[model samples]
Target: MIAHSVEDPLYYLHNFRQVLQWVEQRYADLLDDQELAFLQAFVALEQSAQALMVRMVMRKGELFRSDRLDYAEIGDTVRALQPLQALGWVREPEQLSLDQLFALLRKDELAHGFAGQLSRPRAAKSDLFAQLQGLALAPRPLAQWFEQAPVGILQWCLQPLCDRMRLLFFGNLYQDWSDFVLADLGVLRFEQVPFSPGSRALQQRSEVDLAMALHHCTERLEQGEAPAAILDALAQWRSDNPWLARRHGRLLFALGRHCERLGDWDLALTVYGRSNHAQARIRQVRVLERCERWAQAHELAVQLAAAPANALEVQALQRMLPRLARKLGGPAQPRRRTTAPQLIELELPRELAELGVEEAVRQHLAQAGAEVHYVENTLLNSLFGLLCWDAIFAPVPGAFFHPFQAAPQDLHDADFQLRRAALFDACLGRLDDGTHRQAILDCFATKHGLQSPFVFWSMLDQALLEQALACLPPAHLKQCFLRLLQDIRNNRAGMPDLIQFWPEQGSYRMIEVKGPGDRLQDNQLRWLEFCAEHHLPVAVCHVRWGGPA
Candidate 1:
């Protein structure tokens, strides 16, 4: 755990220093000359200066008004900034674009600066900016733009370098310095996995660069950049790192979806062809079929159907192959029928609508012997998380890089289970010996509230855990857990909404509740089918509101 003194004024600075030290220790070899120089120079700075620099970096945007940076601890903000400016880490830009000028100045300041030019001085700030859009204004310094402007904008020059250091420390861009503060404040807690010397996410500097490039491409795609251009940019790079490669494939998949949405079928097909994402092939088939390329679609669909990737692909192919066969004027492929789960039909009073369909059903089912709880995905997932705590948080080389991770870095990877097979086997082995119940209970008691990809601490309680452990058979749990491990990302969800436990009988039934006009989603149907196939007791409950009439 990260030690932080909240009462200390320099707590944030302490956290920032810790990150730099961590990155320098683990990723020293991967650090470039600039990063190395920054690290060396940063520690030499006065505490006040370092605190102000972290304050600026942690704040949003590159441009910041000096007046807004008034920190009580860092007395004389301008004095603290001088060292940073001298190091070229912070700079006062000589020229600012119209947008920058507009961003920094108030509406009154803008009106004051361009007193004669504005026709509507009383308009909103956005309207005032629109009023200036027509002018062919060139970039100029703050003084040149507005002589009476109270503060100058300072740009954090080394944000990229700092971001690289941050990336090294956390292994991702989404988590920033605030995570440290959050952890310190007890808003977040993480498992303290023992990280070995070899444990780190990126092995090389090139991987770091590749990850950043992929992140940039994703950002551009999100910002409405042309998919073809982004795809062209993406074509220039390839990564040997499985994690980075997965990121590349996911980006390609996204771009393909973007193209399909834009009606660029050829471009979508081209993007999908370049991608190795699990669903990319199916997407290509769908796009081809949409374009009326029946022969090509059928050819790919036939190939996919012969050896489907997973149950999801098989499900899609079952529906798609027959449709493609019809389109290509071939004999209709026999549709594989699945045995649906047992159904329960109910008509409750209209006033029960406030409790929701699942809750209403739970109330109806709850009696002297049976008790129902809305478990959904939480119960099973939490059980899996508790039992497999040792395996999931194993100190594998690349599995765990940082202390803040909720799960292993490769949690969603294809080789997630394969990499930690022995550890998972050991965890699952306890089930056969009737030891899993105790192991799960022990883990639940000890590791509660720690961050986990599976455990929902808020949704689980001791009573629920007791009931589930008592009523749910070990064999049934093993089956569900195995299926969950088969496709962790997709199979983690779509569980039945409510679980009715008969503790005395040592039995339980999962209920998938559906209100009027509600239908089972593909994932839900897949779960239901899996439950039926494994002979686990599950039912689909269709509910309707019945009034006094």
Candidate 2:
């Protein structure tokens, strides 16, 4: 019998898949389009919940990190609710205070007996979503049944977010909410299931499954298992499960890396060739280089450099060329990148130089309600970060745009692009208001704690975030958003030095600080051009160091 730990994260993933299948098979066909809308909303929330849990667990055991997931530290359902909130998936509660409750109560002798009195409840709580979650377990017509339960207000409020949800996830089962009862929302699937003997064996049989093998490999790697033993075991696992292995390209790539790390160049080279990952092929070249197969490595490197697939690939080839040339005796190709910005220089009062130009400008912006913050580095960067977050990442899934582990990597596929663009467009509607502003503040809670991998979310404080969200024009930020998110790894840098935000006017400007000789960087120019294209206000504050000239 294959032995497996009962606590593996795959166990949860397996169950999450079960919920999806249960909903599709049992509920999808039978339900009316309205009920199907509810069904789809339910799946969006839980599917994302499951994805978050699995990502957290797998991320803990990735090769880059040494620490393992503390399963005991796994949080409550509310934690799952938080991510859903990011995508307009939350049901806000309306807590009735004592006076409000008293107002709702029927007139009674006891209530009217006292001339000057007020009624108060011993305990008050907003439990609408919690109550609705409990009620959804039963098979009933959601609208009629909820109205009978007399919570129509909650259902009414649910409509906006539900609409937003359908918008965010590419138009769920139907275009409109019909009045129908759902056959099953799979609430039971949300509960934990104890691992049985059969299931336990299933989770442990890495020899039979590629995902299981991956989980095991990651765990062993994190545990600092002997590399040879790990490699040998994975080799056998792959040989035994060739069919499954063929479907797991990433696993093969990872295996190649492990072998390369162990100095098993032949195994690494062979596995890397078999791995269908573009990066793996690049790795194979490096493995050949390590094995002193200089001619083959050099030839491969030259061919790859001629047609580099991505920025990372281009960089890898460029770096390797010089080293390879040192051995093979040839001149390496030098890549030139020209990214000059539209330069406009300004002259500031020489007396201000004593106070420092950067400081003087920062103080000037602060006088106009642009609070200087220690965002990524400064107040302007921090504000821009939040402005970007409110405009893009908060509304979309974290997995959708992150570089290392982005979701739905069909970047070229029209359907995926259209869906992403739709969400971006819907988000732009909130440009001049406080819509989802709080969610923006809360969505990156993990990042603020420094426990998340998201690049831009965690850097701003509430003060800066509030100011940024209130001040930045949704139109200008929206215009600049996609490019920044697409190339977030590099394009995130070079925001202007100061922002003049006016909350009352819903207006802001990007001010790039330039001393006598400094000019705008490429990323900054990109931002400036986007602003100018949109007819948004931006300026260059060229502060030269000198006395009054």
Candidate 3:
């Protein structure tokens, strides 16, 4: 690690001479002493180049790990190498594709050059439900295969090349399919790959333990498992789970309520009828209401509504009481949150500030006199979408395929993810490179209504969009992508309203806005955590809600 940190070009020039003098003279009997020492220095020097390149891209640091130098199937080798040439450490040796660059670097592997093929076998699925037959009925296990599967050194060295004949028939062998399933396929493609039955791979550490349990229970429900069986398992897991009482109560209440809605009244009563769990008793009020046990339902509803925790329970109790009062022909009035409803004008988008947090962050940083531009949200995610386009979108062969012009059964197919991936990548590449800006713009211009879940491409064009992307540190982009992949719905939505882009320094900060009474939502907290981890500047801007002008 210490050796890898010495990235300065001048240091390598000075150190190489010192290394040769120290190692060669000591191993005097060894004929290849000088060559061995030089090889060792070369490896260190190349690593320094990779490290510096990463520093240039990232604000703090981002780990881009590979099993070995040959793992280009995981990608970005040439992309990483190109920047080194720009840095002047590497003088472009007259031409070779990105794939060939790896072969050239690892010359110790004597072979028929780049023509040699990787020899790895696909591992059999080992999840509990792997034995179940049929595509629809086959249980899609919850393991995160992309993070867990290790592309071992032996994979490339052992076994016959996976579908090497594809290279002869179709020029591009799509060798990514042969090696590194994580690169060519999504985690959803395979069963959870664990390090051992009881342990998991290092990268899989980020996966949430809570999500694993929730997914397990949800899958059991979907598979038509008996409600009684699911309830028993939930009971067992709850005993060992580390979740707080409130959260555990909520989960049980939700699952019980779902079972109740599905006519599993006895199971629902068994689960949610627990008097100790406050939320469960509230749901039991509904179970009683559905069962036409009106007197009991109204009695519990009246008791709970006075201090109900969940909003739905309050509404349900409120709605049910009035009907109950009228049917029983009684004078007991239904309770309301307030005697008179408070009203406010519903007009929105008053545009008090052009970009609220952006303008605010820019002004705040400016007072300290920091040079930065506070830009709004669109460009940040657009650039992120571009960086991840191919990996997220490209369809891997045999991994998934869409049907011909029909509604897609295999959503994991490359084309679907590709749709947004290519659009975002091309859009960003055009803005940054200026090569196909017009063509890319034209493609998007024709469809004014087209909007991506990931990118607001309609608003972003070539020039300024690229500038915003360049300003953001690479660590920020990589971190955002990781968080987005973790939970697509929540992570995608809660990006800060403003980004402070320092064009001259090529850096930026994310600033989230909240009016006086407003608070950060769960998703916003997740984004803030991501920003903090990457050392990307993020702050909550408290805006004073000034009375109407």
Candidate 2 lDDT score relative to the true structure: 0.48
Which segments of model 1 are wrong by more than 4 Å?
1-10, 115-135, 143-150, 183-187, 331-334, 459-463, 547-549
By TM-score, the candidates rank as: 1, 2, 3
The TM-score, computed over Cα atoms with residue i paired to residue i, of candidate 3 is 0.31
Best by lDDT: 1
Instruction: State the lDDT at 58 in candidate 3.
Output: 21
Query: Residue-wise lDDT of candidate 1 within 1-549, one digit each (tens)?
Result: 464767777888887888888788888899899989999899999988899999988998889988899999899998999999999888988888989888888877787788777899888989888888888788988778776766678899888888888777776777788877654454567888986566666888898998899888988999999998998899889677777777788889999999999999999999999987878989999999999999999999989888887778888888998998888788987998889789999999999999888888898888545889988899999999999999998887667666677878778776788878999999999989999999999999999999999999999999999989999999999999998898898999999999998888989999999999999999999999999899999999999999964
What lDDT tens digits, residue by residue, belong to model 3 across residues 208-257?
A: 23334554665676677777777776665533222223334555666786
- Selected candidate, larger lDDT, 1 vs 2: 1
Tens-digit lDDT track of model 2 for 1-549: 011223543444554344334434422333345545655665665654554444342332111111221244344544664654455433333333233223322234213322233232122323322332343333333232222322211111334323332222221213221111112221111112222222211112233234445556666766767655666666665443322343345556777788877788887887777666647768978898999999899899989888875445665676787788778877765653433333445455677776766776676567656555323224433333433343333223212311111223332222222435655555544555656465456644533532122334344456656777687655565655554544444445666666666776777666677777776666665566555656767677776554546
TM-score of 2: 0.38
List where candidate 2 sits over 4 angstroms from the true fold: 1-210, 222-254, 274-282, 290-295, 302-309, 322-327, 340-374, 377-480, 483-549
For model 3 the local lDDT of residue 409 reads 21
What is the overall TM-score of model 1 with all chains considered together?
0.91
Ranking by lDDT: 1, 2, 3
